[model samples]
Target: MSVLIKSSLARKIVMALSGLFLVFFLGQHFIINITSVIAPETFNLWSHFMGYNPLVQYALQPVLIAGVIIHFVMGFVLEIQNNKARGLSYVKYKGGANASWVSRNMIISGAVILAFLGLHFYDFWLPEIAYKYIENNPEDATRYHAETVHKFEAIWRTVLYIISFALLALHLLHGFASSFQTMGINNKYSSAIKTFTKIYAIAIPLGFIFIAIYHHLNPITH
Candidate 1:
């Protein structure tokens, strides 16, 4: 394990795999979250199950957190190592001559996304933990939808969500295609894969933005 982390190639592979895993989780989360806007009852049912499921709460949640840590930490390590290896030559390097703006500034986009994740965890995860574990409150299966809607009641939060998701789109624009490349998936399907990734990069963030705006405009006023 230590030896694998020491190898640059191995580190890239690990980062790529972890990133792809998070992409899958993101898709699943989006699907569930979208239901909150369309079908409140369904959203409540699914949220209740996810919140109480031992497999998710105990096993998958920890693994997901670890994957996020590994990907971000490895990204920072690789960026630093790349900069060091480039040294003085990096000063003369013209990023635009070869790479796209999105590719060149992944670190900036990634940092924004990391900050957004912190906010997301604080808004949702911490409260959920307090409700279920620390406070030992009984589960209320029907409460999820109202809680989700209430979070978007503030315009500031809605705007921040849109901004964060915009940066997330930027991050995915390059990261998604690069993950496949890092995994050495260079076959005839590569073009199709890139096309799908581009759509996903744009669509998922837009979907999240829509969700935020939808709830903000249509608040649960009871």
Candidate 2:
């Protein structure tokens, strides 16, 4: 078990599993947030439940954080290892001949995604944290709606969101089907997986961009 974990293959496996977990999380998060546009009450109620639910708060949230950390850390490690191996190789390697641009530049795309995530946490998650834990504020389900509205009220913030989501789309375009490949899911269904991944990569980011645009155009009337 220890030897397997220490192997390079093990790292890829862990990254693949964690990446898939995060993909699942992204879909769920988008679904929940989209409710703010169509039904304010529904969004607020679900957001409050997610924020305060004991199972989510204590169990699932920690797991989610761990998954994010493990996936990114392993990605960085693998990239560094690959670069080092390339440097030491006597034969020159032309990576672009084999893989697409996005496949070759996963590290760069992942870095951009990490930077956007930091900004996102600062703008939305941090304030929510302050309201919930630090300030001991009462549970107001509707607060998240206004918070999201205020976030998109700034044209710059909305632009930032669109740009970040665009990068996210690029990242997922490569990552989604790659995860399945890494996990040894190559069969007849592999083509379907790739097709679905491409659709998901495009649709989810567009959905997020839509949400930001909607919030920017239709500010909350408080």
Which 10 residues in a row give candidate 1 its minimum summed lDDT?
84-93
Q: Count clashing pairs, candidate 2.
A: 0
lDDT of 1 by residue, 169-195 (tens): 999989998999989999999999999
Candidate 2 residue-wise lDDT, 129-206, digit = tens: 899899999978777788777888889889988998998999999998888988889888899989999999999999
Winning model by lDDT: 1
Q: 202 in model 1: Cα distance from truth in Å?
A: 0.7
Best by TM-score: 1
Clashes of each: 0, 0
Alpha-carbon TM-score of each model against the true structure: 0.94, 0.92
Q: What's model 1's TM-score? A: 0.94
Model 1 spans with C-alpha error above 4 angstroms = 1-6, 88-93
What lDDT, from 0 to 1, does candidate 1 have? 0.90
